[model samples]
Target: MDVMQRMERLVEQLNQYNYHYYTLDQPLISDKEYDALYDQLTALETEAGMALPDSPTNRVGGELLKGFKPHRHLSSLWSLDKAQNEEHLLNWNNRALKLIADYNSKNPDSPLPAPTYVVELKFDGLTLNLTYSDGQLVQAATRGNGTVGEGILAQVKTIKSVPLSIPYRDGTIEVQGEGIMNLSVLAKYNETAVEPLKNARNAAAGALRNLNPRTTAERKLSAFFYNVGYSDGISFADHREMMEFLKDNRFKVNPYVTYFDSFDGVMQELHSISDNRSSLDYLIDGAVIKITDMRTREVLGYTDKFPRWAVAFKFEAEETTTVLESVSWNVGRTGKITPLAKVEAVELAGVTVQNCTLNNAGDIERKNLKFALGSRVFIRRSNDVIPEILGKVTDEQDGEEIIVPEHCPACGFPLEQRGAHLFCNNRLECKPQIVARITHFASRDAMDIETFSEKTAEQLYDEVNVHEPSDLYTLTYEDLIKLERFGEKKANNLLDAIEQSKGRDLASFLFALGIPNTGKSTTKVLAEHFRDLTAVMSATEEELTVLPDIGGIVAESIVSFFADPFMQASIQKMLSLGVEAKAPEKSSAPVTDSFFSGKTVVLTGTLHRLSRDEATERLEALGAKVTGSVSKKTDLVIAGEKAGSKLAKARELGIPVMENEEEWIKLLDGEQN
Candidate 1:
């Protein structure tokens, strides 16, 4: 077949698989089979030498929103000043102690008791700032710029994990929460992953950022509302009771949260939480320990970032021992080789540490890691990050070194030695290299092939002669069904996906191509400026040097990628496949103007934005400063109709009010440039 016919067929085949996996959640083609087709296309395009803008390789992160609209947070969201270590935490406790002492000195008859500390898991996910008015959900946003954020209320509601409305009535409440994705879910997703997600945090972040709320919903994103941002009608004497009341109201509270009276107790629980963190399904980076007494908490108040009463206690990296079963090396897009240690499963922190990344040849050699056919190796999970091997124990070891491969495991190409690393020079000919390249191309931050799971990707590798993403359009349903675990229904679905993927946004397509160091955000900037992949490829390294965030390293990577024979061939294949690499339709909104500009606004109701991040980002961009509570310094209060105490306080403080989205947006429009 001619190149054009081969490319068109390749696009058709790959689209079917993409649709079945991403949209329908049913995969037809085995991953390895799909990869083989992608490989052929990549090779052809490289040979032909051109970039296809609409090829699955492009859809990653796009242009930054010109500027987000500002919404006033009903409660001013403050950042927690960090307590770096136990010493800092102890000092904070002492400060709290002194504050209580001074309070008792003023009121001798009714002295406040010793303060208790509440400790909860500090999730590493995005921060969700929420406002509730009269027991109804209002604004939800991210903690963008700490003061304003993108408004994503419509999208936030779609997450079944976040309650649409609070259970209580006749009261206003402000809540702080964490949006979390479990490690197990991430693992399950990665198990079938074409390219395993880097970590759960990245997965959750990507899922949260998706424009399609349905995608967020399918991710099973969950939230834990830990703090009352602002509230009326209901009051808690302490943080513990507040959490309890939040749970009583059906908010998904963190169950591991507890209260302690002494620093020793706090320390003990910190250790306990750290020891058991991996056992929990969700990912947690540290523990948040907060003062319980509201009265004392008020005196302690907050800094610009975090609450003075609260501090996150991060656990030290933990190390454990596991038996090294095998050593395998995987080829990377840069042609660098990474050694992986396969070990018998052993518990560490909360989850089982099974496999660890050895990084490179230098890493393997530096540790003197000679694994007996079955000897114990010391495994360490550093600060809840991906586990790695610190060293090997040769003392009375049970296993000997498992030989590292001299050639590519998938394509049988001779490996090349480059200072402390092994390289697969086979480029387009190697199956492992091709599959990895294609999978990286379709990743969320890359081309964003949502349905490309590891299992399917592997099947494509093992079954189909297909090697890269561009080759996907060339496969037939029969080819897909021949792979293990794929039937006719599944095969048809995979075929359908390949068809749909042809029309994705341009930035996403660039990201899918798996160029080294060139991620989603970078892709967006380049796509917007160049307007097409052809321009990008034709541009000189010097021309790319001036772009924002694109420095010497990134510019070098981009230039090197375009210079590669394989990349050139893949681009041609994409063109032949009829992939359109053009910039997406731009939003008409002015880049500078925003609603909150030059306004001192107080938020006093539930918001439609995702959380405080949304509201903060909006307000900041438009030149508005959002404060926590109503005070003499306040200017205007944007009360979302059903605002609670802050609303009343605003009135008492004689602040001007814009009662709804119409008036608020109108007032904002009047202030804009």
Candidate 2:
């Protein structure tokens, strides 16, 4: 088929698939089949130099925008008055009752119906208003001032759940929803994300407001439509009817919406929702209660700021204001110095908050915590993780300045600033840096030195003057048994483990070297690409950057790390001591430039060529992190027949997948070649 015709067909198919997977929570095809079609569609779009407006490829943004344009909403997106506690909610309900009673008394012949309510979760996310015309989503905006807002159509399109088109094509309509990032996605993102997100709310909001729509797509935002703000072709008699219309039109409606005949029932449901909010994947700050009757809402009308028919029952605050007492700097294993804020003991999110991560020197300055000592600061705890300081409660800088150390906290070596972080260059004299390096070298993913611990490294460091990784190899049983904690058996076991690690593959050995900005995936790629220690150590920054997963920073780090004469000497010494960091044989080497190289892949279903164990080994040998389950971190999935939830999940996540058994065999064949 021609590119245009083929592109059109692919777009229609992919859009339907997206609607099914994201909105309907079901998949009609395997991830592999869908990905094949998607890959073809993307290739055609690239060849044609254009993508259809509704293409799934557009779900991820292209380029950065210069600025946002203003969008005048079709109808005003009114805010809801807030009720903070039981007393406030009761007062609001009583006021609504009084208004209804007064209206009923005036219109005795044609009285309004008794008041009922529709309760929905108040999503703690950025408010989004989408305008559609003739079944096509035309514009999306923020609720800047109800009437006028920033247009973010491209950013909003990145939300897979937000339909690019709908069944309703008669005229224009406006739908109101909240854009949110799921907490689970956030956690998964933080696993490999260079800069981890602080909280879901900020992550969602910041992504939507970012100049680049690509940032929005990276956050994996979801949206739920709740209000038909403006509809030229349709109207609803109640909130329930409006929600039904939205769902029928393929818009995502939150399932938590419920109608109640009595305000007491609504109140009870609100409490229940708040109690179970922690179990939800998305953030909800409170419950929204609105009068269900459209006519009743018209009679009640709107206040200057909010709709008189609705009120937001706000939940208790998770954030707490605490006084910043001091800031402490500590060196991590990477030799990077991080700042830790010491706050006054305050209760927040059911935990006593004292210390919080300041991230780095740049973070402290950006958060305005550089001069925040003795000032009250806002702190938040998320997902049971460590509490983090948001910023000072006020912008006033009338406080003691947080000191930046010129020397390392662990050792007396001069500290140098690298971007936002400070690092110590003393790999030999610095006790903590060397100890941390050795500890990391013997860790599981690295050399797998069994029974090795930081305590053992510390003991060796202090007593035997063992400072570097090579120092450990030079030690004998006599050297280890002399330590306080080491018995004869313990010493012998440790020595054996160290000896066994000498035969670890080149990839593991490279990872154990503790190169900054280089992760396991990068190290594997390095091993696969160079295949020898000498070549990898001699690789240039430009050459290294061309390899998979190795960016400029990682390239520079690798070059700088290996260039050190001391590092070269240490490696030579380890080699002389019988550390055989051997490269795989020519035929057994991973395809250095394969698509799967350096990607975290998951294999599911039945394989025709090999068992799961053999496939995993081949994938690992091919430089892929073979995992058991599919997550955001998974880069690919090779599915066979009867591929179950894992394959479906891969489809839902837009992961690259292929179920072609013939192609699988070809790849396995290449492993032998």
**TM-scores for the candidates:** 0.46, 0.59
| After superposition, candidate 2 runs with Cα above 4 Å error | 1-122, 126-174, 179-224, 227-320, 346-351, 585-673
lDDT of each: 0.69, 0.85
Tens-place lDDT per residue, model 2, 509-610, is 999999888888788788878999999999999998888778888889999999989989999999999998889556555567765688998887768778
The CA-based lDDT of model 1 is what?
0.69
Kindly report which residue stretches of model 1 are placed more than 4 angstroms away from their true locations once superposed. Answer: 1-317, 322-325, 370-377, 382-385, 392-404, 448-451, 458-464, 476-489, 587-673
Error of 2 at 260 (Å): 19
lDDT tens per residue, model 1, 438-552: 6776665555555777667767867786677888867788788878888888888777776667777778787877767887778878888888888888778788889988989
lDDT of 2 at 606: 67
lDDT of 2 at 338: 88
Say which candidate scores most in lDDT: 2
